[model samples]
Target: MLKSLITAIRTLTLFSVPGRDTESFSNTLFWFPVVGLFLGLLQALFGYGAHLSGWNELAAALVVLGGVVLTRGMHLDGLADLCDGFWGGRTKESILRIMKDPNVGSFGAIALSMHLLLKWIAVLKLVELGAFTFIAAGVLLARLTQVVLASALPYARREGGTAQAFVTGAGWMHISVASLFTLLFLFPLLHQDLHALLALLAASIAAGGMTGLLSYKKIEGVTGDVLGAASELTEVFVWISGALYLLLSGNG
Candidate 1:
């Protein structure tokens, strides 16, 4: 269990150790939310500190930048690749080929910019509302969405790829475990406000589902890029939902 926890941390974060066994890294999918919890704590700390310092704009920017840096910008890369492939390609083959290319195109640049802008705006609003808790919850839900996608979708690559291991190794057990972690973290954070919690969950699941459906339609299954895109979209959707809730409640 300790090894699995370590493997989970190593897999999801920038942290690494020499001679670490990766044989069970896929099994660590059940612990993805655990990593999310750690990420959320960091985001909350950073945002809270900036809020205390009366730099809400800087806080929002830093929180978004912190997420990118902490995850090594892998999800952002996936979002860019997904946009470049989905819009730039005319067919499945072209889409897959385009996504594999290391270069970012016009579509990718636009998509990445729009996503970051929306995220920054949402974070800024949440900061104004003193709603740092939702940032952590958003992070947790983002990873939980990944677990859901891995368990539900088959791997897209016929020749196998980085995502194949997790798709093949993870199952309902993994999903259940990850969901348990999500509920454990999320419920306490939002138990005082059920409406906000439900809205965030609904938005997150919807975003993840739409992402998976699009991937299935395009590639007949999910890929590493799809998973990454799903995570980023889920995060954005959660933040948007929470932000909207704050606005409607006159808290923003």
Candidate 2:
């Protein structure tokens, strides 16, 4: 268990776990949980601390910005690419072509703006509801979405890169292990609310499934970028769902 965790950390973060090298694609599968947990914890700390500190919306936004910087905007870049692809082209092939290009298109710019705006609004809503746990879960599950993509799809690229290494070694077992840990962390926050728990789980499953299908139809297969985009977008969906639930249930 310790080894797996260390492997996961090495793959996900800047941390160099003993003998692990980031350049090797084989170690990518091991990092999913590590990254997910780390990012999740950070977001939790940020939200909880901000709320406790009586920080306003701007301060809360800074916490999220801190997270984005910590992750080096890796997922955001993918989100932009996905946005460009989905909106720029009429055909699937044309979309893929735009995604492959390093340049950001107009669609990408618009998408990035909307994503950032939505994330800020979502975070603000959670803060308003005092739902720190949901904010943390959103962060965790976003990264977990990446793990699911890594586990389920093949990398599009041939020569080994970050995506290749991860997709190559990831199996159902890795996803299961990551998911087990994710659920454990989430269980504490559910506070015995079986209905809310089930709702969140169903939402996550549906979001992931939809992303997977989209990846297959548009990209032919899932690449690292696709996986990253899936993580961020799924988190957005989960956040919206959680906010709505809290608002409607009078729990927020």
Candidate 3:
């Protein structure tokens, strides 16, 4: 279990591992939320420190940068690929080919820029509102979406790629375990506020479902890039939802 946890962390972040353990890596799906909690803790600490230092804006920017750095920009790259493929490719073959390419096109560049900008703005708003809890929760929810995508969707590629092992190995049982972990983390944060909890749940489901549907329509299945895109889109959705909730409730 410890090895699986380590594999989850190493695979999801820029963290180094002593050695590659394929078996452990295969079991890492169940621990995805744990890795997310670790990330959330880091961001929460940074946000709290920023609050104390009277540099919330700077801290928020750093938190956003930290996410990119920690994840090695893999999610962002996936988002770019998805954008390029979905819009640029008219056929499944073309879409797969486009997504597999390492080069970023104009559409991809625009999408990445917009995504980063929106994320920065959302984080800035969260910091200003002192909603560190939401930041942490957003990370957890975003990662949970990835686990769902892996377990629920068939891999689009026939020639198995980087994410194939995970998708193939993760079953409904794994999804159940990951969902349990997510609820364990989320319940306490939201138990006192049913409205907030419901809103967050709705937002997460909507984001994940929408992304999955789009991926399915475009390619008939999900890819590693789709999972990456889903993670990023879900994070942004959570942040946006939380920020809007705060604003509407007169807290912002």
Clashing pairs in 2: 8-30, 8-31, 25-165
Best by TM-score: 1
Q: Which candidate tops lDDT?
A: 1
What TM-score, computed on C-alpha atoms, does each candidate reach? 0.96, 0.86, 0.94
Per-residue C-alpha lDDT of model 2 across residues 1-252, encoded as one tens digit per residue: 455556666545555667534444444554565567577667767776777777758645865786687677777788888888877777766776777788988887888888888888887888878877777777777767777887788776544455676677777877887788778778877676777777777777777788788877776677767877887787778778888898989887
What overall lDDT goes with each candidate model? 0.88, 0.73, 0.86
- How many residue-pair clashes does candidate 3 contain? 0
Off by over 4 Å in 2: 1-7, 14-19, 22-31, 89-97, 158-161
* TM match of model 3 to true structure: 0.94
Off by over 4 Å in 1: 17-19, 250-252
Query: Between prediction 1 and prediction 2, which has the larger lDDT?
Result: 1
lDDT of model 1 at position 76: 93
Instruction: Order the candidates by lDDT, highest first.
Output: 1, 3, 2
Error of 2 at 67 (Å): 2.3
